[model samples]
Target: MKRIVEFMKRNYKIILVVTALSAILWSFIPREKKEDPEKDKLILELLTMVLERGHYSPVEINDDFSKKVYHKYLENIDPTKRFFIQSDINEFSKYETSLDEMILRKDISFFNLTNSRLLQRMKESRKIYENLLSKPFDYNVKESINIDYDNLPFAKNKSDLVERWRKQLKLSTLSSLTDKQKLEEEKKKENASYEEKSFEVIEKEVRESTLKSLDEYFNFLEKELTRDDWFAIFLNSIVERFDPHTFYFSPEDKEKFDVSMSGTFQGIGARLQKKEAGVEISELISGGPAWRGKELEAGDLILKVGQGKEEPIDIAGMRLDDVVKKIKGPKGTEVRLTVKKVDGTIKVISIIRDEVETEETFAKSSVVEKDGKKYGIIYLPKFYISFENKENRDAFKDVAAEIEKLKAQNIDGLIMDLRDNGGGSLETVVKMVGLFIPEGPVVQVKAPRRNPEILPDPDKRVQYDGPLVVMINNFSASASEIFAAAIQDYKRGIVVGSKHSYGKGTVQNVIDLNQFIRSSSFGDLGALKTTIQKFYRINGGSTQREGVKSDVVFPDRFSYLDMGERDEESALPWDKIEPAKYEPLQINYDNIILNSNKRIATNTTFKLIDENAKWIFERKDEKVISLNLNDFNNELAVADEKLKKFKAISDYKNTYEFKSLPDELALFEKDTVLKQKRERWHEEMQKDIYIEETLNIISDIKLLTKGKSLTQKLSLN
Candidate 1:
């Protein structure tokens, strides 16, 4: 989920100010060193101090909290219960209730013990997997393995662990064998003379592939991760006991988070994925320096990275983040990359780093026609902003620009799609709500022992006054919820989508942990993102656990699943305050909602989606899987047979043709990559039954508005 952050303002300084910490901890400071345990201790002390003083509602650091952190840290490190055995757990269990004391005293004995033991266990696991994959499995063996890891106990001994590893590998290989056999049969059906590989040959090939994957997985663990990474996981377990959104971002992770929030970074602009061979380019951002150079292509393995005139360092086995750090630098600086192309050719490509904007993160609009009238859909991926530069491109400015473009097209209605928009800047959301309604209170923010601060749009200008719709889904969160809740409270627009948006109402502020320390000898102390406040709707309701429910609900595949902020154990409870004084827009959507629901009840695609949702809920906990080839194939055949009834859901398509706005058409001539992306989006939109129903709702609203206006004209006559 994206963070909804409130930047450091004057008032917030009072709560976070820890001026006395420097004087108190001065004697405990250590000398300058590359890696220091003393630095870790200092960070822990600083984090707890800030959390206790500045967090909106901090949980007490008692034994109960210690037990939660203990289990959570262990579960996060070894989620599948493959690395640690019962003996390791027994050894670690002794300190489960004492972690709170350790934190209080800045002692890391528990963390150090677990970290070393995990490393040892991981080393032993490599040999176990290697030995198991060296031989073939007997598919004739009739056995089943429970895939549920949470309830499964740790192995009793080393031998039991090895047996556990064997069964897991055997299950994987057996599934692959059955799939290969089926594909061979399909090839024979397509061409009777086609030569198929032997069953034993395919089995060996699958085993080799599985072995390579394991090698890469272990290689990442050994080469990429460090002690600090594990320590960050442990730190997060401590902070998250306060709430789910509170977290500790390592220096490397903090940089990444900044890039995500801004959606612009100075870099090569190519996404990389680590594989067994090396780091491979997944996609080159359109209009980026690498894309402009036209030399580096996706699937090319980056072998080395060099800055300016320095000698290139081999990155064959280096961590991906470190490799990225070497490649990305200040704008106009030269970086050379040695890459192996997909055709097995080696090339050295030098490119200048520039500010690359991720286009997908911004707002874009599409125009579609229905019932002889045009409607505009503006898709906002997040409420992003550059906290460092005010003039930089942001969600509010881009969306306002899109609205003007749609106005130029003379569209009758608008749809603001916030599906999967986790959220971003809180300030941006307040301004974005101004685009739809007149100047009014947008949302309410409350901190611990502070009066409610009512944020409003004071421009007194409405950018779009026509029929409007705000679309959301289960994944839409924080700032998205604020926008929807405001619109719903004002009765300015119809909120439509899954039951409600993601319920994340709290606000986080990332504090630079190094600011409180006077010593540069300890290096960067990373950052702490703690929840310092909770936001409420203009109508006095908070969207903490109960998110902004849609005015018109649509059945979705995830309808019955437990998700969103409500599912988080440490999520803040829902509450309310006095409502902000504001007048609701004079628009009634009762008929509009009623009409949409009537149509949804008869829609066959929606009915099938409801059935699919029910089917998914029924099998949500079907964890026991067959390890035998015959039984596995039988189970797959039965599932496939049952899933045939739902195939029409994928085949369902609408007749509406979505197209890019007038401005994007001219740019598409030089930027074919962007054109291809828009074409794919349009294709997906055409098949979206939810969008089709949304268009119908907009049509109903338009008709209602027209009728109301005509009555007013008659009265004037």
Candidate 2:
């Protein structure tokens, strides 16, 4: 390790030179200038607008604040510039006396300082501005000029009110707080008469409220800090000197982001979030302590967690990070959580800490009957199984086991629901696809300047070769797309659901910024999420800007929402590559389409969805106002009426009453849906309107095959 370190140190200069050259070359590359000057201008305008008109009370602006904000913007754009260095600082020092005047005089040329040195000075100016704004100010003061309170309405409570006030105060007090201080002192004295309380009571109240208020304030601060306006400014300062992805993370944010990306942390295996009322159980990770205990459920709000009943710590208004720290401990330690169930009942659940196994994220299936026909319904919440922990129980294995159980029931068709599945392990997806396809490449991954690697099916044998229908929605992404793409490419199954999946085609590689930073300067900073690779379908089309368009689209309200990859800033452009070669499975889709038309025409659910979509569109942009008490009540009545109409249309099947096949009669069921699918895989491959259409196509093929067999026997006679 020492030798390797020595070698890296010795070759560090070479690496830096190579990196610098690459950066220079990439910067100059004559690619299509996708840079939107309008967007850049809009960003600048937005920043200016936000600073000018934002909720900051007693809004004020000064040359110092303007310069700092401007510097922040520049830094966000480019962080690695030498303008942050001492030499550049010294250069800016020469212009220090005239800098404010230059800014006030609107001297555009003043900004034309050399890129490296100017960036450094801008960074310094940004810090100065931040420090100036950080000083306390009177948020309640109303500015005569530039009064904007657009976001003030969104403040729902006292805490939100305070946040709005703080935003205004920060803007107004920018470098001019002496007057504000005087006003605050005067206001305090004026209020002192009405607010007469004993000093002891006041102190006690202050001390008691401090923690809760601080927690609320920090929560608000976190949201404010993460806002695009603030983040852009923050990043602009640092990124100007480093890579675009490099970022500073507060300790709290760093931990949360890490847990989000990794999906596992050293905890009791329960996901919790701080809600308006209290800390709530977001999810009980399977095989985790909470999950193994089988006492907690999603939506169970946590009131407290402690070693014993008496020592319970009230977690109300606590930051999620802090709550997590309290709950998580070394494996085998006991932690008890007092929880309120969704039904209004409260209970205490004790769980022992252990490594959480995220294998059961995907739901297993069993055969159920609808109109006396046995069907396999596999409920997949998210296409997740840990690739990092492949040895033990996982999604693929569990799903396979469920499929086998369904097969034992001799089911005719399969419904693989991908709705709300945000996607997970690419490896599990490949293996899951392999269960359907007979040993072939499932998906292709392409990296920069490298040939695409094909992830082939892991299994050689097919399992339960039946009519397969993949259910998807707008939430489906990444691994979900991979599975859908492969199934579609092979003509293996029909895709069903929303207009398209979430277009998250590119992958992110997390870089621990703390590791790269000089330890002496900043300690334990956060990580940077950098775009590393893009995933493409085996058929060459990317699930990038354009997500996977389903074969059979379903109506969803979110269809109108601008959600997915294209909406994200700095998202990589989408393009196609040469398609991978594979043997195409011939399917008779003509009949399937014909059948789909008939089913869709008759399906009450589809009709209601269409009507709902139309209604939604009609009122999409309608501004609702309810000033009077009667108007508010009437509006609510109208909303409830609409909901009632929807509920009336919904034909909710009794899921619990749905029966599974008995074990005794399973094997001899030759005419079952599963048997027919295996017999007619080729014929059904074409008509995948939904998996049911595929099944219908298979049934037709079976009839055709049976007819041909009879004809052959008659000919022999």
What C-alpha lDDT do the candidate models reach, one value each? 0.82, 0.52
TM-score of 1: 0.85
For model 2, what is the C-alpha lDDT against the true structure?
A: 0.52
lDDT of candidate 2 over 372-435, digit per residue (tens): 5566767675555544456766567877887887877777667787754666666677888988
lDDT over C-alpha atoms for residue 186 of model 1: 99
What stretches of model 2 exceed 4 Å from their correct place? 1-233, 236-250, 257-360, 370-373, 517-521, 618-626, 649-651, 654-717
Runs off by more than 4 Å, candidate 1: 2-11, 14-28, 31-35, 262-357, 707-717
Best by lDDT: 1
Q: How close is every model to the real structure, measured as TM-score?
A: 0.85, 0.54
Best by TM-score: 1
